[model samples]
Target: MPDMFCFQCEQTAGGTGCQGRAGVCGKKANTATLQDELTGALIGLARTAMNSTPTAETHKTVIEGLFTTITNVSFDDEAIECQIAKTEAAKQAMAPQCSSCASKCVRNDNYDMQNLWTDNEDIRSLKSLILFGIRGMAAYAYHALVLGYTDDEVNLFFYKALAAIGEELDADTLLALVMETGNVNLKCMELLDRANTETYGTPEPTKVTMNIEAGPFIVVSGHDLYDLHLLLEQTKGKGINIYTHGEMLPAHAYPALKAYPHLKGNFGTAWQNQQKEFDGLPAPVLFTTNCLMPVKQSYSDRIFTTEVVAYPEMVHIDEDKDFTPVINKALELGGYRELHPMTGINGGDTLTTGFARGTVLSVADKVIDAVKAGAIKHFFLVGGCDGARPGRNYYTDFVKQTPKDTIILTLACGKYRFNDLDLGEIGGLPRIMDMGQCNDAYSAIQVAIALAGAFECGVNELPLTLVLSWYEQKAVCILLSLLALGIKNIYLGPTLPAFVSPNILNVLVEKFGISPISTPEADLKKILG
Candidate 1:
């Protein structure tokens, strides 16, 4: 028997599962168990929600618990245990009689996750899909909730899907729930889309530098734009320059965020490169959400975590949202003495982002004209979470080999693979257009729909291909959303998910025409043909 069981990520051990003392993502067995416990408690809460009316706080707790279990999010056992206790209190408040029932029915109890882990293989696989999908959706929901945006249907679905995890449902029923999870997630993503655009204004095309100006600075990583906005406000005129790291890079495209002169340019490349990039760094790095790697001693003291992204011994910014500690660390480090220039994988000094649906649709006529005139061959959405795994270079090579006439639209950190490359322009629009962060997949879908309308055809009929590289559960929900929309022929890699049993994989392949990526040349030939 193994000490832990975690195979929710693409980089799971042996391409099957992780069951040793630690996972490939550096999560220890004890911490993994605690996360499982927290998830189990959330399940109990979900079961209670089905019976009684749930408060807004109840929905937030469920989202928080699910988001905390995502890969590379929370590694602090204490934080997770605290979350578990909070979940228990919420459940008890909802069903107070269950605590003192003399019947000993064992109902309304925190489920033992081991049951799901040890269930029938096919059954377990289907349930895992629902479990992981909602876990990913929860991150998006948490972001929206923080911004004061949410959908009742989306919140209600969380409880429904979670309760299903604790039930002994048939494969057909569970599978239907899996697709429903995807469908509801689409609504969740849209809610977040509205919250972001309406709150901060629609994003516009903007260029971000890779070079670092000398002086005290702070690097904000993860996906919380509100956290970055607060830091930008608190540090206004404080002489401390701020830079976006990883998924936060898209912040530069927002008119409101871009208005901050001290926001500066991006720092480092992707989440996977943090250990090497932040080593002995003279500045503090504030993590607002996921993709937080295990801190190294060289820069652990300089790391600060806010919201649900926690690691042991790091200074965690409480709900108060006060960034005084992070700001002070930046001042203490004092940054580099001279201009420090940084280039991306392709040796380019600048990266461009903010080509969301509105921006793309604004130029729909030009895109249609180029396609009709044969100047543009096709559109490839090469996006998803980037990770520290081999074979990921496939994305870079895949993008590089694309026909000069075609356009590469990307989002999320995976763009770091070749985003720096000067792919040049076609019809005044760059060959490569970055839509936004992972959640901004909503933007990509909207662009596809508009293009389909322009061509007087279904989205499947458009000359568009989705080549996605996934790493975490957030990728799972996005893939589900794509499936729910009847989007077909998605080519996923560097490897298929371990949580996806052979049986489930077949369902995706047969129904959706989904294929695993082979190589740049081979996939290009197949897609182009």
Candidate 2:
């Protein structure tokens, strides 16, 4: 007998499923059923918000509901149960209990995910775009919240998109909503960009060593700058060193952040590789957000989660935003005995970062001159998160195959695959430019738009092609932003998302000219040709 049943979209446990007595996370089949019900309930809540005026409470519930189902956050049935209750409460608040209706409306009706999974692939993919895009945007919004930043339009779209998914919508209608998801995500990213750069000065070119400093140190991961700042402040003068982990690696380039003396260096590569890297770390680690893999037994106690990122038994620091528990753990571990030299995957001791718009555009004249004089041939934005899947080799090989005359721009964790390579430079600009973290997709978009203006061409017409790798929701939102801007012909993959139905994939391929990446050799031939 099957233990459980779940095929939410194209990509589930496998092409088939992990229908066992329980999920790998130990979730019971009934809970999985309830979670699906909760999702449907949220969709209903979204519909109500769409057709009726919503209170502020409704908005908060919508954001949190979508945020919960993202890859790795809540594994607790109790938590999911609570969220479902909250959704119903919000629904009741929106319209109040209906007074004596002939047809009793089910406020807590559950959505049959199978309906979504079985729908025409194209429509499913469009809805997946709306769903996944909001999930990722919610993460961004949450980060902005820790730093005290929020936007009304960004919140409203979550309701609009979710409501559309539950309603009877056509392919064209859903596709338009998918693009709209991208449009609001752009505003969301802009809010975050302003929150970051304004709080931590514009990132300047800084050389960050991979080395871990001696004595007590703390490792900070995730996308929260406010938490990192708080830790830096708390750990100061405590004989503790702070090191960046995962997406936080780019923090070394920001002036205000880098100015902190105790902020030492980066501890590891990307998020996917954390289990292997954190196995026996001498210092305590803190996760501020997603991209957390299933924790291993060895380092489970040493790890802590803050904000929305929660794992069973891991110490979760709440909204006061206090990080004392993390600081204490770092001191307890006492780091390395002495400074140990470290390098990137390429064996380079120091990785150079901070090529956001300000830095790149500051050298705009030089870049333009280089392109004009034939010194620089093309630009390749090779970025996104790195993954454990075998198909990820395409990114490493694609970067290796690009022409020497091309300048490579990268962001997010995907660069972990090849950031160590010394691709040299065209003129004074390094061949590979690290444009901050994933949220810094704003930087990549800014750079592209600027280059297009400089060359007097549309972003798509410029001699630049985007080869993107997506692992989670953040990447999904960024891809939507690219499409919303009408930039066409993006090369996306290691693998297309399991959630995108074939028909939906076809629409993207037709409208945006999206190509699933093949062998680096073959794809490069097509891109450069």
Candidate 3:
């Protein structure tokens, strides 16, 4: 048996699941075991979805069921057990005609992840991409559902991809499937983009202060915009201010969300720093998605979970999405007695975001002019998940070493590493551009495509380098998206995927020009050479 601490989930401290008698949140070993069973059953359901065109309900069920097993979500064994049973029921329902068939396929037996994890490295990496990419895609799907937005193609692919992962497959086939994950993810992301823009209006360039104004307020974290919208609606006229945290930082960019008078500012950096940043906070915190680290006892009681996020003893608001309990907790906490001043890790008082393609392309003329004049020598997109691993220092050093003339466009939790550092500017533009959450990688891609068009070059030929650090599935999908664009020379780190076999890695290296991070100095030399 492994020790008690495992961070296998996005919010986990390390990459492995806590395998002790109980998880950090008091998740019993039995519960973790059952969660594994739930995951296995969901995979089976995905297999069913592959063979048949599932209903709308089936798509939503697959997304929610898989997402629930993500880290820091449901620790309730009973809830997980119910979900497992529900998944099994779904599998049976989808294959109702097969029960009486003489041809009984034993391949439907539970697909153990151990087989995937322990498989040949290349196959493992490809399968890992499919599995993790879907897991992250499920979060996006769940958020889209919250806003009454759903896509048939996006939903169906979840089944197809999940089922594929369960089947015994070879390297070349799995590699193609891995790339397809990126293609499907693009559709899934488009659905979410429509959901957010339709619901909240397209995001505009906005400035967010680091200071948490004095007043009763609620700090909202995670990547779900619908939850933020609902909380903003409920908190309207309630004198409670709302601040975005981690991946939620980008929510401040949307026109509908930014229009709220009480939607004050951002709270903290990335998920990894939450335990320290949220300690003794006077306002309640609401988690709307993944990348939630283990909650500390100090602030656990004040935390609330909506959607799939759950923890032992934490109040989980159901689908009703009513935020009254969270609001009341903030009201009771009474927030800060005075206007407390706060700054980012770099002592910058505020961080301006919402520079997605819409805003960036709107000013393409100035950007192009700067590039033509040599004011901007390069563009480095240093983004992705921020992990606790010692290897993660590459991001910090990479950003610090970026040429002074280069502009750094960043999104997701990875920006926390360098967002605070005032890297100055190229021309009149701030060198360090915070484009928003992980899903906002869509915007980064858009910007790159626009820039390439302006310069009459492909995205790969442009001076932009995507140096990413991935720790979870959302990162997986985002990387897939980059590859789908035929953008090569991507530098990925802090460590390669555990599931990626040596042969698979070699293929990536030869085909995509993918290289693991060396030292910042050496990698920078190679990239700039």
Candidate 4:
């Protein structure tokens, strides 16, 4: 009668695995169990696909099945059950003879998560890396798939990685697979970047306001741009405004998305504050993906979910993406009677984003010149998911304490900590540049590699530091991508991942120079000095 165990995220209990009736991410025990079943079925399908050629349907099923189990993606037991059945169906299609054969072999049987959870600590750590890393990578893949972009190699690796998870592999073998997960994730992120920029024009620098204009409006949250685009199209001339929330904030920078006048400014702050911020709002909130907290009664009636994101009793918009219900709800709410002024956590009334790789690289000459002239002393990439942990303020403080001569390139929701704060400009560039969403970490890496090439050195030799704050599985895969690229000396906080064993942690520290973040003042001195 014990609870499920999950430690793939940074918010795990006591800096260890979440071992209770529910996950700290608001995932109930039943939902967690169903997620485990879905994952197990996916592993079985992978085991089957390892021998047989996988179809495009098989690849899509593997990507979605893995993405569904990521932290906060699916909360509906029914939805997860559907995923489990689909995975089993895919397995049967690939290995049709296994089920009907008189001689039954368990070679491709589903894996019980408990085995990996209770395995040798080091083995568990390594396997967790492959499992959770892919779980995060799957999100990027899902996003790309929706945009009509697919990579066969990325798809094949999902099967290879999941099959390895179910196998009784040695530590070294699993460890190698763990690194491969990182390598594969880098490619996945790149595929996503290409998909997004091609579908929507490359992101450019644009400033967003925090004020909610008077009128009916719908606030869209999550990482799905396609959902936002569909909503914008459906809501055109309907007198309903659309506001981006959380990861959707970066949509403002996309020329195609910004062309829709109804896509107004962002609303609320980071995902963690939704319960408090959404209370009694005059608008409906549509969630397209993860980072959904347990809904409170105060605003649960106004919450809607689409795609993989779900909550019991909340209205769900199916694949057809007909958002009439959401639009009607927005019209009913009618939003605030007059303009409502809003501010970021730092009390800034405006937010700036769109400093994606295209924008940054376009001004490469200015940046290189600034650095050579000592106008920019250092470059800090301070970004990741923003969680409820008290220590997360370290990001805000870290950005605040960074020298005036330094440039801060931020991405993901973590930038919400101090994004609105005007850090002034260096060489005609804002001191802190918003670099789009978490997957846009691809953009940041591109900038780093470009800079290294400009300086005629490796990325590690460049004057750049990655001070990251992680909350979910996406952050896990991003960290892996960095390590896989041989980028080192990353300052990670507010805490280390609970799934990382002591020996594994030691290996990371010694090999990658990964360090847990300290006080902003101390860490600043260490990095600057």
RMSD of each: 1.0, 2.7, 2.7, 0.9
For candidate 4, give the lDDT: 0.92
Give the per-residue lDDT digits (tens) of candidate 4, residues 1-529: 3578888888888888777798888888888888888888888888888888899999999988888988888889898998898889888988889999888778678988888888999999998888889999999999999999999989999999998988888988887788888999999999999999999999989989989999999999999999999999999999999999999999999999999988889998999999889999999999999999999998888999998888889999999999989989999989999999999998998999999999999999999999999999999999999999878888988899899999999999999999989989997999999999999999999999999999999999999999999988999999989998999999998989989999999989999999999899998889888
Q: Which stretches of candidate 3 lie over 4 Å from their true place?
A: 1-31, 96-110, 118-121
Per-residue error (Å), model 1, residue 35: 0.6
TM-score of each: 0.99, 0.92, 0.92, 0.99
Q: Estimate every model's Cα lDDT from 0 to 1.
A: 0.93, 0.80, 0.80, 0.92
User: If both were scored by lDDT, which would come out higher, candidate 2 or candidate 4?
Assistant: 4
Candidate 2 Cα errors over 4 Å, as ranges: 1-12, 15-35, 55-57, 98-112
| Tens digits of per-residue lDDT for model 3, 1-529 | 3234334434343344455687654466776677667667777787666666677777777898878766556776666776777777777787887667788775455577657656665676677778778888888888888889888877888877877877878877887888888888888887887788888877787778888888899989889888888888898888999999988988888998888989889897778778898899998999888766667889887988877676767888998888889989999999999988887766777888887777788889999999999898889999998876677877888898888999999999888887778778776788888887788788788888888888999888898888999877788788887787788999888877655557777877888999888899998898889
Model 2, residue 514: C-alpha shift (Å): 1.6
- Per-residue lDDT value at 56 in model 3: 77
Report the CA-based lDDT of candidate 1 relative to the real structure. 0.93
Name model 4 segments beyond 4 Å from true: none
**Consecutive 10-residue window with the lowest summed lDDT within model 4:** 1-10
In candidate 3, which residue pairs clash?
6-17, 6-18, 8-16, 121-500, 121-501, 122-501, 125-499
